[model samples]
Structure formats: structure tokens, C-alpha cells
Target: MQALLNVILPVFIVLGFGYLAVWRNWFSQAGVDGVMVFTQKFAIPCLLFNAMANLDLGQSFEWRLLSSFYIGALSGFALGVWGARYLFSRDWQDAIAIGFCCLFSNSLLLGLPITERAYGSGALTANFAIIALHSPFCYGVGITAMEIAKARESGGRASFFKVLKAMFSNAMIVGITLGLIVNLLNVELPEPLGEAIALIARAALPAALFGLGGILVQYRPQGDLRVALYVCVISLTIHPMITFALSFATGISVEATRSAVITAAMAPGVNAYIFANMYGRGQRVAASAVLIATGISIVTAWIWLTVLP
Candidate 1:
């Protein structure tokens, strides 16, 4: 209960404030979009850059830890695709978009903040480690699968180069790549520049959370209630359960297990809808899944926090 109150509720409260402000017309949707743009493109990238630049790569990037989390993510994607096609009768394009919802957890917005509050700042190394590959890996899988699906539907060849181009062109990937270059070369930024990055990084989470709330207000549950709930089940439950079993089987440290399971436990990110919208498929399911799963996670996360050692 204390964890729920102290760790989880505050995060949701910030999200709720954003939702309330938007719904009540106190905050314009345009303002919310600007905040999201700043956070996603600028502030959050700075945060990742700082984390990657300073992280002890040797200590943090454990293969077992990464594999455990990613395997679960992959399973969720596979299952989401299979279920959407076989069970729900969605087309390949829509299935791929739905599968992406299961694949892309909200690692930045919800995962980092909740984990930080529950454990502490020192406990974030594994979280950062997982995040380092998250955007690239998820986007890589999603775009590739979608391209292949598109190719099959139209009887054309999938564009491998286009996938590569899209993956590298992302701002988050750019920030992460630059950070990696600096880390590998042991390049130290000027003190003033580093401090400036720190200042921007500090604003990333809170601003992102508020913007996320406002965004959610725009994604009210529409049609496709059943399929959306199906996505919610896979994202909020199955993903974390798989991570939990694998964490113990692999004998990772307790902290790594916590980070993996908790991150896996987060709702599908807004990127899920963006991916669906990008392809003009499964937009309703993706949007509703994001909103519904986020609400469901308020309880589910608390439950997982209690379950985790």
C-alpha cells in the first residue's frame, strides 16, 4: 500500500493532472503537443545521452539481463501477431501493428520514473542498460515485420534499406549513437556543456509524464474494445510474467530482475499508436490499448511490485 501510494500513485497523479488539464480545456492540445515534442525529441534524448555517456558499460550491460527482458518482449510480439490474426481475424498489416503494441513498453515515460521512485536512483543502471537498446530493437523489429507484411499484401519485395534508413533516422537513435561514440572514445564534454545537458535531462521525466496525460485524453476508448483489451492483457500481464520466470531461471541479480520485470510490466507506449497510424492500420486498437492498458497498469504495477523480490 505504501509503495502504491508513494511510488505508483504519484506518477499516475501527474499523468492524471495532465489528463484533467486537457479535458477541462485548461491546457490546450497544442500546448500538450509542444511539451511532448520537447520531451521526446530534446529533453529525453539529453537524458539518454548523459546516461549512456557516463554509464559503466562493463558493469551494466549484462547479456543475461538483456536476453531475459528481450525474449519476453519478442514473445509478446509473436503472440500478439498470432492472436490478432488467428483469433481476432485481423489482416496481416493490422496484426503487425497490434503486435507492436505488445512489443513497445513505455520504458522512458513510465518505466524509469516508477522504478526510480520504488527503488532509488542507484538502482537505475539496469534500467538504463535495457533502455539503451530498446528503441532501436523495437523499431527494428516492428518496421521490418510491417514492411514484410506490406510486401506480402501487395506482392512486392520488402525494402530492407528503408528499414535501416528509418531506424537510424530516429532522433533517439541519433542521441544514443552519439553517446555511444563518446563513451567508446572516452570523450569528455566541456564542463559547461555537460551541465547544460544535465539541466535538460532533469526536465525529461516530469514533462514527459504531464504530456503523456494530455495525450491520453485524446485517445478515449473507441471501437475495437475486445482487441484492445487483448493487447492490454498481453502487455500488462504476460510480458512481465515471462520476464519474471526467465529472471529466476537465469539467476540474474535481484535488482536486475526487478528492473526487467517492472519495465516489462509497463503499458504499451504512445509509439504503438504512432506505428499503427503511420501505416494506416489498427489505429483504433492501438490507441485504445494504450489508454486502457495504462489505466489497468495502475493496479497491475502495484501487484507486480509486491510480487517482485
Candidate 2:
């Protein structure tokens, strides 16, 4: 109960404020767009930049830890695709889009904040490690799967260059790449510039949370309720269970297990819908899944926190 109150509900309360403001016509969709642009394009990138710049790569980047988390993610994607195609009777392109909803967890907006609240800021190094590779990896798999699906549908070849261009063009990926260059080369920013970035980084979470809630206003649970719930089951339950079992089997540290499981436990991100919309496929299912799964995760995350050590 304390975890629900202290760690979970506070985040949701901030999110709720954003939802209520937008729903009541007090906050314009334009304003929500601006906030999302600031957070996704600038502030959160700065946050990732600073975290990556200062992270001890040798200590944090464990193969076991990464493998445990990613295997679960990949499993979710496979299951999502298979279920959408076989059970729900969606076409290949739409199935791929729905699979992406299971693939991309809301690592930044939900994972970082929730883990930080539960375990303290010092425990975030593993989360950062996971996130550092997250966007690139998820986008790589999603774009490739989508391209292949499109190719099959059109009886044409999938474009490799197109996939690379799309993956590298992401602002988050650019920020992460630059941060890696700095870390690898031991480049230090000037103090004033560092402080300025720190200022922006401080604003990333709360602002992103608010913006996410406002954005969720646009993705109401309208259609494809069964398919949306299928996504929720995979994202909130099965993914984390797989990660937890693997973590225990591999005997990684408790902290790594916590990071892996909690991150896996988050709902599908807005990128799920963006990817679906980009392909003009499964838009309703993806959008509905994001909203419904996010609401469900309130209880689910608290349950995971209780179970984790």
C-alpha cells in the first residue's frame, strides 16, 4: 500500500492532472504537443546524455543483464505478432504493428521514474544501461519487421537503407550516439554547459509524464478491445515473468533483476502508436493498447515491486 501510495500513485497523479486538464479543455492539444516536443527532442535527450556520459560502462554493461531483458522483449514481439496474425486475424503489416506495441516498453516515461521512486536514484545505472540501447534496438526490430511485412504484402524487396535511415534519424538515437562518443573518447563538457544540461535533465521526467498523459487523451479505448487486452497481457505479465525467470536462472545481481523485471513490466509506449500510424496499420489496436495497458499497469507495477527484492 505504501509502495502504491508513495511510488506509484504520485506518478499517476501527475499523469492524471495532465489528462484531466486536457479532457476539461484547460490544456490545449497544441500545448501538449509542445511539451512532448520539448521532452522527447530536448530534455530527455539531455537526461540520457548526462547519464550516459557519466556511467561506468565497464561495471554496468553486463551481457547477462542485457540478454535477460532483451530476450523477454523479443519474446513479447514474437508472441504479439503470432497472436495478432493467428488469433486476431490481422494482416501481416497490421500484425507487425501490433507486435511493436508489445516490443516497445515505456522505458523512459514510466520505467525510469518508477524504478527511481522504488529503489532510489543510485539504482538507476542499470536502468540507464538498458535505456541506452533501448530506442535503437526496439526501432531496429520494429522497422525491420514492418519493412519485411510491407515487402511481402507488395511482392517487393525490403529496403535495408530505409531501415538504417529511419533508425538513425531518431532524435533519441542521435543523443545516445553522441553521448557514447563522448564517453568512449573521455570528452568533458565545460562546467557551465554541463550545469545547463543538468537543468534541462531535471525537467525531463515530470514534464514527460504530463505530456504523456495529455497524449493519452487522444488514444481512448475505442475499438479492438480484445486485441488491446491481448497486448496488455503480454506487456504487463508475460514479458516480466520471462525476464524474472531468466534473471533467477542466470544468477544476476538482485539490482539487475529488479531493473530487468520492472522495465519489462511497463506498458507499451506512445511509440507503439507512432509506429502503427507510420505504417497505416493496426492504429486502433495500438492506440487502445497503450491507453488500456497504462491504466492496468498501476496495479501491475505495484505487484511487481512487491514481488521484487
Candidate 3:
């Protein structure tokens, strides 16, 4: 219990501090945005690159983990779509929005930090292995599906190739690609260069949590309460359950199975909101789902950590 609290308390404290900062107007929105940009473009990329560059990919990579995690993720996504379409009487765009809310875990900001602390940095190799697959599956499929739906609605055209191209151009994807190449070639980063990367990478932790807090302060749950609650049920609860069951059924490595399940337990990714806002479909509902899921996830994550082997 003490060990678990040690892992969990600091995360909430940092997140709480960020919320207090923004709530009290100590950090303006612009200031928070700047910090977020740094975290997204520099700190996170550096962190991922450093982790991947130095690791033994041969031993670290787990196909079972990816398979099991995605199985759960896609399952949750399909459920969200069906629920929104039939249960909530939503159109396809709204269903896709809800589906994304269910599937996309907040892997970078919340999952990475919590997993690093809760399971230790040793577990990070497994978590990053999941992170490597996150954007590809979540954004690649989610964005393409949403775009296709929008185009169909508007009598326009949409292409999966465009979505793939945009997704590959993402900074995190670029970092992951470079890191994989380096790891595959067994390239040793020089001491100075490695230290430089490490210094920048270290900033991701606090920056991400703080950014999350600030963004939460801005999000108002002004949407369909029923739909938001339904999304939360899928995202915060069902997704993790599916992940655990699938991971166990697959009999993956202990570390990979644990990491995959825990990552699946994370709250809805903020990118869900970004996509909703961009498409202007079910924006408020997406925000509401994120808010509710994030608030509820603290308890759910602790429960998962307590119960998981």
C-alpha cells in the first residue's frame, strides 16, 4: 500500500498543483499552451527517443502485448460506435467521436508517467512498446474513419492515404521511427549527446501532468450527460477489462501483460477532444467524456494497480 501510494500520490499532487495553478490564474492559458507545446514537441519526443535509442529492442518488443492491447482497444471502439449509433441515436460522425473517446488512452501524459512510477522505469520499455502502436491505431484509424464519415456527409472526398501521411508527419511518430532505427542498428549515442537528450526528456514528466491539469480546468462538461456517461463506462472501465482478459488469454510475458492492461486503464486521451473540436462534431460530449473519465480514472487506476499482479 505504501509502495502504491508512493507511485500514485505524486501524480495526483502534480496534477492537482497544475489545476490549482490554472484555477487560481497563476498560469494563464497562453503560458500553459507554451508549456504544452514544449512537452509535446520536445520533451515527449526526446523522452521517447532516449528510451528507445538505449533499449534492447530484441528483448523489449512484445508482439503479444500489442495484439492483446489492440484487441481490447478495437473492441471498445466498436462497442462505442454501436452504443452511440443505436443506444444514443447518434449519427456516424458522433459515433466515431464517441468511439475514439472509448479507445484512445491518455498514454503519453498519464499512462507513461504513472506506469513509470507505479511499475518502475523497468516497465517503461513495455509501456513505450505500447505507445509506439498507440498513434498508429488510434489516430490512423480514428481520423480516417471520422474524415470518411465527414466527407460522405458533405458530398466530398476522403482518403486513407492522406490520413496516413499526416499521421506519419507527427513529431512523436518521427521520434519513434528514428529511435527504432537507432535501436535496430545498435547505435550508441555519444555521452554528451545522450546526456543532452536525457536532460530535455526529463522535462516531460511534470510538464505533461501540469498541462493535463490546466487543460482540465478549461474543459466544461456542457454536453449530453447520458452519452458522456456511456463513453466513460466504455473508456474508464470496459476498455481495461477487455485488455486484462485479452492479455491473460494470450499468455504474454508478465511485464508486457501487466503494462498493456494498465495502459488500457488510462483515461480518454485529450486527442479525442482535439479531433472532436477539429471536426466540430460532438465536441462538448467529447470534452465531457474526457472530464468525467479523467476524474474517475484516479480511483480506477488505483484499483487496477491493486488488483493486477
Candidate 4:
């Protein structure tokens, strides 16, 4: 109860404040969008780069932990895709979008703040690893799948190089790459540069949370009730179960295992909606999935936090 009140509640409070700000017209829709863009393109990358640059890479990464977490994510992705295609009779693009909602999590906006509150700052490296890979793996596969489906629609081949180029051009990927290079080579950043990065990174979480809350205020779940319900179940329940089981079976350190499981349990990310909108496929369902999953995750996150040590 203390943890919930002190840690979790504050997050939602800030989120709620954002909702209030928007509703009260303190911040216009354009203003909120601008904030989100700044957070994603600048603030988040700085935060990720700082985290990756500072962590002891050799000691931080455990192959078993990485494998277990990804296996769970991939499994959920596959299940979501298959269910959308066969059970829902969705096309490949829409199915892949749904799968993305299942696999991609709100790692930046929600994961960092909640985990930092629950497990302290030391737990961030694992979360960083997950975030760094989130865009590349989730978006990469999603774009590729969608492109292939589009090609099939027109009787042509999708370009693998195009996918690679898109992935490489991602802001998060650039941040991750630079961070990894600095870490691997033991390159020390200049004091001013480091401070500037840290300063920008500091605002990422709160701003992101605010933007998310504002988005929630706008994106109501009015699509197919059944599709929304399916997304909610897959994101909130199945993802966590697979992550927990795989982490336990792999026998990573208790801390790492716990971090992986909890992070995996977060709601479907807004990125899923962004991707869906980009492709002009299943945007309504994707929006509903993210909103519904976020609403439900409050309870599910509390449950997991209580059950986990």
C-alpha cells in the first residue's frame, strides 16, 4: 500500500495533472504534441544514451536474461499476429499492427518512472536495454511485415534494405549506437557535453507521462469492443506470464529477473498507434488497445508488484 501510494500514485497524479491541463485548455492539442515530439526525439535519446554510456556493458548484460525476455516478447508477437489473422480475419498489415501492440510496451513513459520508484535507480540498466531494443525490434519487424504484405498486395517484393535503412535512421537507434560505441571504446565525454545530455534527459519521463495522459484524454476506445478486449488481455495478462515463466526458467539474478518481468508487464505502448497510423491500417483498434491496456495496467501492475519480491 505504501509503495502504491507513494510510488505509483505520484505517476498517475502527474498524468492526471496533464489530463487536467489539456481539458482545462491550459495546453492546446498542438502544445501537447510538441511536448511529446521533444520528449521522443531529444529527451528520451539523451536519457538512453546517458544510461548506456555509463553502465558497465560487460557486467550489465546477461545473455540468459536477454534471451528469456526477448523469447517472451517474440512469443507474444507471434500469438497476437496469428490470433488477429485467423481468429479475427485481419489482413497481414492489421495483424502485424496488433502484434506490435502486444509486444511493444510503454517503457519510456511508464516503465522508467514505475521501476525507478519500485526498484531504485540501479535497476535502470535492464530497462534501458529493453527500451533501446524496443523501437528497433518492434518497429523493425512491424515495418518489414507491413511492407511485405503491401508487396504481396501488388505482386512485388519488399525491400530488405529499405527496412534496414529505416531502422538505422531511428532516433533511438542512433542514441543506442552512440552510447554503445562510447561504452565499448571507453570514450569519456567532455564535461560540458555530458552535463548538457544529462540536463535534457532529466525532463524525458515527466513530459512523456504528461503527453501520454493528454493522449488518453483524447483517444477514447470506441472501436470493435471485441478487438479492444483481445488487445487488453494479450498485453496485460499474457505478456507478463510469459516473461515471468521464461525468466524463472532461465534462472537469472533475482533482481534482473524481477526487472524483466515487471517491465514486460507494462501496457501496450503508444508507438503501436503511431505505427498503425503511419501505415494507415488498424489505427482505431491500435488506439483502443493502447488506451484500454493503459487503464487496466494500473491494477495489473499493482498485482505484479505485490506478488514479486
Off by over 4 Å in 1: none
Give the worst 10-residue stretch by lDDT in candidate 4: 56-65
What is candidate 1's lDDT per residue for 1-309, written digit by digit as tens?
Answer: 998999999999999999999999999999999999999899999999999998999999999899999999999999999999999999999999999999999988999999999999999999999999999999999999999988988899999899999888777888888898899999999999999999999999999999999999989889999999999999999999999999999999999999999999999999999889988999999999999999999999999999987
109-145 per-residue lDDT for model 3 (tens digits): 8888788887788888888888877887798878888
Arrange candidates by lDDT, highest first: which order? 1, 2, 3, 4
Q: Which model, 1 or 4, shows the larger TM-score?
A: 1
For all predicted structures, in order, the TM-scores are 0.99, 0.99, 0.95, 0.96
Candidate 4 lDDT, tens digit per residue, 1-309?
A: 877887788888888888889989998989899988898889988988998898777767777777777777888788888989999999888898888888787877887899999989888878777776778888777888888989999999999998998788778788888898899899998999999999999998999999888877787887766877787787777887888888888788878877788778888888888888888888888888888888788888888888788
Which candidate comes out best when scored by lDDT?
1
- Please list the residue runs of candidate 2 whose C-alpha ends up more than 4 Å from where it truly belongs after superposition: none
What local distance difference test score does each model get? 0.95, 0.94, 0.85, 0.84
lDDT of 4 at 23: 86
User: What lDDT does model 4 reach?
Assistant: 0.84
Encode model 2's per-residue lDDT on 15-89: one tens digit a residue: 999999999999999999999999999999999999888989999899999999999999999999999999999
Ranking 1 against 2 by lDDT, winner: 1
